[model samples]
Target: MENNKGKSEWVSQQNYSESQSTPYCITRRYGSLTFEETVQNVKNGIKKLGLDLVGEFDVREYLSSDMEKMPRHLILMVCEKETALKLISNDIQMSVLFPCNVTIKEVENNTIIEVSIEDTDSTWSSAKKKEIIEVAKNTKNILKKLLDTIEQQNVKL
Candidate 1:
């Protein structure tokens, strides 16, 4: 996709068939922010939305420590307590997907935010499917809003 500046945008959308088990992973680029700045903004956004930050993993640091070449990357696991509770109550097996993941990484000169869209196509019951989809949709919206906010703020700089 092309942005207003005619630059190739950094957004991804993947469609999966029933036989494919991969979940959708969406990524958007923030061209005006540094990696550190992007990460901080994401954390602040999560807090502003009243979500719990389970943890952050510094993938790049870990890989680099082993003498591997990798760009700066961080993964944040966040979740809304009430949503998580409702999901678990619907299907305990869904706990494996708890705490959605958001990623920050440096690509070329830009910082990219990545989020895995929850997979609601599991073989669970109808009630469970509906509940899971609802939680997933809410989580996706929250993450997208965070990215949008960062992009807007950076553009004003």
Candidate 2:
């Protein structure tokens, strides 16, 4: 709830929440930053966290018709070197979830910055594998830091 200056910024608008699925997981954090600003801040966070930027997919780029008018959405594929190595070393099948996805999209007419992180918890949750659990926990921690970092990067309205 604190801004870069350590003061309350958009605490009223920022809603922090988490959502999950069977095999797929998502950790979402909301902010008051502009869509463009969130994208750039997230990109910086990926590198700052020492995660490799595999690529960035612009969901809006696929639009060719009226769909082009949709809200801006972008997907950033970020991979932690050590995390990946540990995962595949544990089981090759885990490669299917390689490169955690950090999605940035504008919601409510660009009034809020929605960043969703791919949480690797479910994969370890069912198997109850200690090794993978540690790695997943670490990765989730780093991703959480990334979200906070983006929030600390503030701008005055």
Highest-TM-score candidate: 2
CA lDDT scores, all candidates in order: 0.62, 0.72
The lDDT, on a scale of 0 to 1, for candidate 2 is 0.72
Compute the lDDT of residue 150 as modeled in candidate 2. 87
Candidate 1 backbone collisions, by pair: none
What lDDT score is found at residue 24 in candidate 2? 59
On residues 1-157, what C-alpha lDDT tens digit does candidate 1 reach at each position?
5224332222212121221234455556655677777777788878887888999888767655343336667888887888878888888877777677777765543334333333333312344477677766666677667666665545553
Q: Could you give candidate 2's per-residue lDDT for residues 1-157 as a string of tens digits?
A: 5224332333234333333232455545455677877888888888887889998888767542324346677899989778889988987777887788888876654677778787767545554678888888888788878887886767557
- Clash totals for all models, in order? 0, 0
